[model samples]
Structure formats: C-alpha cells, structure tokens
Target: MELNGVVSAWLLSTVKVKKIKMSKQWGQKAEELEISNKVAGLGLGQKGSNQTSDTEDGPDAANPAEASLLMKIIRQGLVESKLDIEIQRKDPNSPLYSVKTFEALHLKPNLLKGVYAMGFNAPSKIQETALPTLLADPPQNMIAQSQSGTGKTAAFVLAMLSRVDATKNYPQVLCLSPTYELAIQTGEVAAKMAKFCSEIKLKFAVRGEEVPKGTKITDQILIGTPGKMLDWGVKFGMFDLSKIKVFVLDEADVMIDRQGHQEQCIRIHKCLPSTCQMMFFSATYHSAVMEFAEIIVPNPIIIRLLREEESLDNIKQYYVKCKSPEDKYRAICNIYGVITIGQAIIFCHTRKTASWLSEKMSKDGHSVAVLSGELTVDQRIAVLDRFRAGLEKVLITTNVLSRGIDVEQVTLVVNFDMPMDLNKKADCETYLHRIGRTGRFGKAGIAINLIDSPQAMEICLDIEAHFGKKIQLLDIEDAEEIEKIGA
Candidate 1:
C-alpha cells in the first residue's frame, strides 16, 4: 500500500501525547506502566522482566560473536510471531514454482488464455497460498499480509474475477485503495488478470462524470478510490447489494489510516450484501489497523508470512553519534569526505527537514532533490524519474519512497532522523522497507543513521531488538578507528 505521504510519526506523536496524559492523570511512571497488572492482562508479558542490566555481557551489548547469536534469535522470533497468528505453513517442496502455467488452477479457459498471454508461468507465494483458500466451497473472508513485489496484486485480482458474475453486470466487485496511484495500479492489474477471463467486464468509475446518457453499465468489475466510487454510486445509482458477491480492499490499512477516506470505506461496507466476501492486502499494517479490520471482516482466514530477513546483511549499518542537531548537520557534511558513494537517500521526520537538508546538501556541491506530498503527483514522478535515470545523485524525503517504489541506483539510505514509530511491536517492517530500497534484487547497499539524541539511541535499540540485527556505531571523526564489531 502506498500512502501519499508520511504521517506515521505525526499520528504516533498524537497517540503518545494521549498516552502520556492518561499516565499523568493516573499518576503512573513509565516503569510502573510497563509492569502494571493491566499490562499483564494483555497476555504479552514475558515470564521474567523485559529489562536487563546495561552491563550484562551478551551479543546484544555489542560483542561480535554473541551479537550474531542475538540476531538469529530475533529473526526466529519474528517468524514465530507471524506464524502463531496465521495457520499457513511454508513448503520448500511445493509444486507452485515448478508449474509452468496457471492453467492447472481450474480457472475458466478464457482466464487461462489471459494468464498465458501475460507470460506468467507458475504462481507467486501469495497466489499459491491464497488461491485455494479463496476458491473453496462457501467462500470466506481473507486477510493477506505480504510485502510488495510478491505478486499480492494478482492473488486478490484472481479471487475477485473467480467469483464475479457477468450476467447482470452493474459492478459486482469493487476494489478500493488509498491513493490514486495505487488505485490505478490495482485497476491495471485487475484488467491484466481479467483479460484471461473474457466474460468479465471491467470499468473504472469516473468522478464528476456520468456513464453516458443512454449507455448501459455492463461492467462486472469496478476499481477506484473510495471517493470516486462513492461519487459514482451517488450518480450512477446503487447496484443490488444482494448480487454483489465479492469485495476487495487493496492496501486496506492505508485506506483506513486516512481518517476522511475511512468513512467512505465503511459506507461501501454498509452497501455490500450481508454474505459478501472481503479480502484485504498490504505490506505494513499496525495494531490499530488490524483491530479495525477484524470488526469489518468475518472469520477472516489470516495468512501472514514470516518477515523477510532484514536486507541489511550486505549493507554496512553505521551510526554517527552527534551532540546536537547542528552536530548532525556537520556530520552529514563530513560524510562527503569519508565516502564518495554512487547515490543516497536522506530520510527526515518531516517535509520541512527534508527541504532544509536538500538545500544544505546542494550548498555543499552535491546534486540533490527533495520528494514529499506537497509536490504534485507529476512533480513527484518527475523527481523519481530523474533519480532513477542517475540525473540526481541524492534524494531527500519524509518516508515517501520507503516502500513500493524501487530505484536501483541508490546504494545508500541515510536516516537523518530516526523513525519514531516502527508501528508493529514484534517486526521492523517500516525500518526494513526503508533500507530495502537499496540492496534490492541481491545487490549490496549501505544504511547510515545519524543519531543526535538519547531518544534516537533508544529507537535504535528497539529496532535492533525487533530485527535481531546489529547496527554498528561509527565515529566518523576517526574513520580509521571505526569498528565493525557486531554488524
């Protein structure tokens, strides 16, 4: 799911403030809250305290040999947590990869032809696990969680087409997304997959535009953003809720994250048939988002795969400790002398920071461009195109290109400001996605983190605990003395 911009830290700041207010009213210290009886009620507490002595000798404390073991444990924990929540298992010997074409999936002949034409042989991880469950007798609600580039788009599209009715075509299936880009992306994917099923009619809704005066609406599938879909419903008239058998929300979590758009999603649900099946897909889903999903879906068949190992294996993780924000700026300047890398992405906590950093980098004679939601969609695409074409060696942004968007030339990812919220408790999805931009398709990469405060160190430790990966600290002032003890 692609969000138009980064509001996670902002949203999390609000959540933190509210929590602090509640804690103060109840007169509870952070340590007290951590071990409170109420926390124990959540059934997430360890048998012993989560706290350990700072002097404890272990790999988590920066020793090389033990740190490697710490990473292994953290990786195991990530996989275990996901598996515990879902009932699916990984089959190394599954025939999915060996299968040459999707024809054996029992799809209609027209659909088979379309699949063949798309040049897809065999199925992706998402398609392999999700298809059979979706095609079973008495269809069930499904909740699929997989990273982007895993072909999740095809899995949901196929599910929608398989159940769509072509006889009375007035939009029997509706797929909603968060942004225009992702909505259009999903619509394009649906069109490609449905091309194999010749009988299915697909039409994307128009905004402030009507389905021509005398034209009959014969499309069996409708794909659009919530706002346009809602607008079309008010203009074109609502279809029979009873006949709409399938509903899919691509990038469901992001749709819910945008407060105004979420209302439209709920309204769509209200208009769907009581027996309609719903499926949701996304790479990063938070606790609040998952809670909202449970209320919307019925007995959903949840399938969450093991979190992919942090792509930092090849990337040298480094941190420069600075005394203040200004010190961080100086450190960034010094980095130019230490390493002349190909290209890099500097991430900030807000658009203001991104803009300021880009200006400073440019002043230092480095080619730089800034990306944020404040720019028009065309402007954003233009920046991306330039970066991909090697015209821009450095790009600054506020989590805009953290996920979904892939640019290969970027060999380094710099975190100017530590991400405040990793979102999920057990997995570092946001952190991994940011670094995954580099070191993609099995190439090497570098991730540099500039730490200027104690809170930043805390965030780093939490990320390390979550991913079980050690990010080495670097003293950029003494480049010759820098050590790779753990990372």
Candidate 2:
C-alpha cells in the first residue's frame, strides 16, 4: 500500500504512529509471503544424495586445516548449481547443514582417500547436505530426492561405510536395490570407494549367488534386490537382522510402486533394530509413497531440490569455463575417469569438434566412437551398436543423436560447445534434448558444458534465463572438485 505525500500527511494526523508502523510491517510481510510462495512451488530433486560431517569412519577426525578448507569452500560459494536444497531437521535449533567437500565431513582417513580414489573429492549438492544427517551421532533416517547418476550410491555407500565396525563385521550394512543390474552397479561403486578402507567388503545378494545352509556370510556390506534381501535376511536367516546398522532402500519410488516390493520392504523393515539408520533415496516420490515412507521411517531428514521442468530433475548439469578449445579438451581429460563409469555421450556443436574430440579421447587411451550427420545410416547404427555393447565408453557426436536415443548405460553427457540456433541465440530445445540423452529410463545422469568465449557465455546465460536454472561453474584445474563432474 503506497501513500502519496498528501495521503501520508493525512494518515500521520488521523492515525496513531504505532498503528501506522504496524500496518506498514503487515504490508511488507504480505509481499514477502507472496515471493516465498512462488519459490516454494518450484519443482524438486537433484543429481546425487547429500552428506555432511556426522560419524567419523575412523579415528582421524578432520583437523583445523580440513575444517578451514570446509569453511573456505562454503565461503567461496563453490559448486553453485540451480540445486535448491531445503533440509528439514527435527531439531530446528540444531539444524543439519550442507558441506561442500568430503574433507569437511571429517571422515576416517582411509575412507576419505577412498572417496577421492573413487573420483569423488567433493560431495554433490545432495551428498554434501544429506551426509551429516546420515552420519549424525544419534543417527537419523533420511528420505531424499535426487536425480539418477548423481552420486547417491556413493553418498549412501559412504554412510554405510562410516557406520560399520570392520572388527566385528557380519553384514552391518544392508542396501536393497530394485533390480539385479542396479544391485551390481551399486556394489561396484561401494567396492571401488571402500577399497582403501582395507577391512571393508561388499557382496551382491542376487540370483544364483546364495549361500548354502550352515555357511555364514561375513561380508560387511550386502547389496541385493528386495526379494533376495528379504529371503537372505528373513527366510534363510543368513544375516543377523538385529546387527544391521544401516538399511538403504535405493530407487524407493520404484520399489513401492512395484507389485510386491512394498510388502517385502515392510517385512524386512520389521526385522531391523530400532537403532538402524533407514534411508530412502529416489528421483521422484509421489505423495502416497512419501506418506508411506513417513510411516515406516520416523523422524527422517527430508532434503528436496525443487524441479524446474520435465526430465531436467534427472540430469546433474554443470558448465566448465574454458579459455580455448584445447582447454575444453583438457577439461574432458580431467573428468574422463568419472565419466567412464557408464557409457557417455559427448555432444559437440559441429562435426569437426566431434571428430577432433573423438581422436583426442582415443589417443588418450579411452575407448571412443564417433557419430555425425555425415555418417551413413548404417555407420550411425554401427556406432550406436558398439556404444550399446560397451565396446565404446565415449560416443562423441554432433546433435544427430540428441533425439530418439535411449541408451540405459549412458550416464554422462558432455557439451563441448554451447548450443545455439541459426540466429545464434541459445537453442533451448536442442540443449534440453541433448542433455536428455543421458539420465534416461529413470537412471541418474550427468551433463557438462564448456563455455570458451564471451559468445559462449552469452549463450549459456540465455539458456539459463530460458529455464530459470543456474549453470554453475566447474573448475577442471582443481583435482578435488574434478571428482564431482559426473557425480
């Protein structure tokens, strides 16, 4: 409510000053509420699950240097993406927070090295925030929403690792995935990250791998499909359900929506000790599933990144600031280790850049393939066939493969150049479709862009304005930060 000079004078004479001040405060509060509502109504979810400083995996807590580094990263505002994270903790006075790096989490020394060894120096937006809650001393259950391929596997894996006692290991951590492939994939990530921890062991409880009667299974972490876990933990009585410390239900949305998984999960949940840390991680959760989760896992820390549009929530997107084409190639080389976990699709603005990158990636000892509009239909088919068969981990191309391509294994997508239209404006549709190549079939995925020039920055800003999502900077020079590329 605006008052002109004459109206203000009249109000001062007619109304009490205290009443006028109260009215002004009410008007300001109303405007603030309207803005807050618009933001709250944004969509949700990000690439990876979150983490923070909770339980130390080993005796070595973070020193002053590490703590300083943590504060520095937070102060620097590093790794800023359009990931709007809202953390709801039961203790509002003692709120949980987001950490920028694993170093800040004060993890065990070996475990910290293992995180970096797994090519994860810093946590993704989700992992940084979600970890502390997962690792808190009294232990809190967490219901988290993150995109596929966002390092959620690693986040939960680290949580399980932090809570385990290798000396008394007998299946302390149990993770239930929805499928054999997902179980294997998660087991792979866990095994890789836990390698430096020495005493830690991970086993997949999928088909044809069951233990015979009277034999004990000693693996510290057990990952499996719901039915296998239910049978192994309940029917067979293989794992001492009471001894389990962490129970993770990955792809939980799918688990609940499936025909029989809900019952199996519930049966298994009933067997777990009250002290166990329960975690539910999924890309999307309907209100019904969320309600059910609330019933099963009480007092959970909820972290959500509001969604902007369709399928965008599935892709973890970032941009690298490069000075030249060579620098862009260097950025690719830096993240090559992380991107190779699954098949990758690197989109160039033109066929020349694609060909050049294909050559460089191959020369750098990567199994690379090329696809372009110049290729014959048969050639394109052959390239895709090789990529699908895992013969080529990296598929460099122009925009030809942007649409009608659904490779479940493609977890990484690289935009070596910004996308633009014929008028040289940002090509919002093509840009969306290009990154959409990854994060397909409800799987997690990562997308990176290289902005080398002022024009490229302009294109990125235009794309940013189009979607109302920020394209945060990625520094290839920082080895620690580089681990976050495909996370």
Give residue 161's lDDT in candidate 2 (0 to 100).
88
Residue 208 lDDT (model 2): 57
TM-score per candidate, chains pooled = 0.70, 0.51
For model 1, what is the alpha-carbon lDDT of residue 87?
A: 45
Residue 469 shift from truth in candidate 2, angstroms:
16
lDDT of 1: 0.62
In the range 217-283, model 1's lDDT, one tens digit per residue, is 5678777678767655533344444457888887665565454565566666666777898887765
Worst 10 residues of 2 by lDDT: 1-10
- lDDT tens readout by residue for model 2, 297-405: 8888887767536677777778889988899988887887444567888877666677778888888898999876555445666777778788998898765555445
Report how far off residue 76 is in candidate 1 (Å): 32
Candidate 2 deviation (Cα RMSD): 22.5
Query: Model 1 TM-score?
Result: 0.70
**Candidate 2 lDDT score at position 436:** 83
Task: Please give the RMSD to the true structure for each candidate, in Å.
Answer: 13.5, 22.5
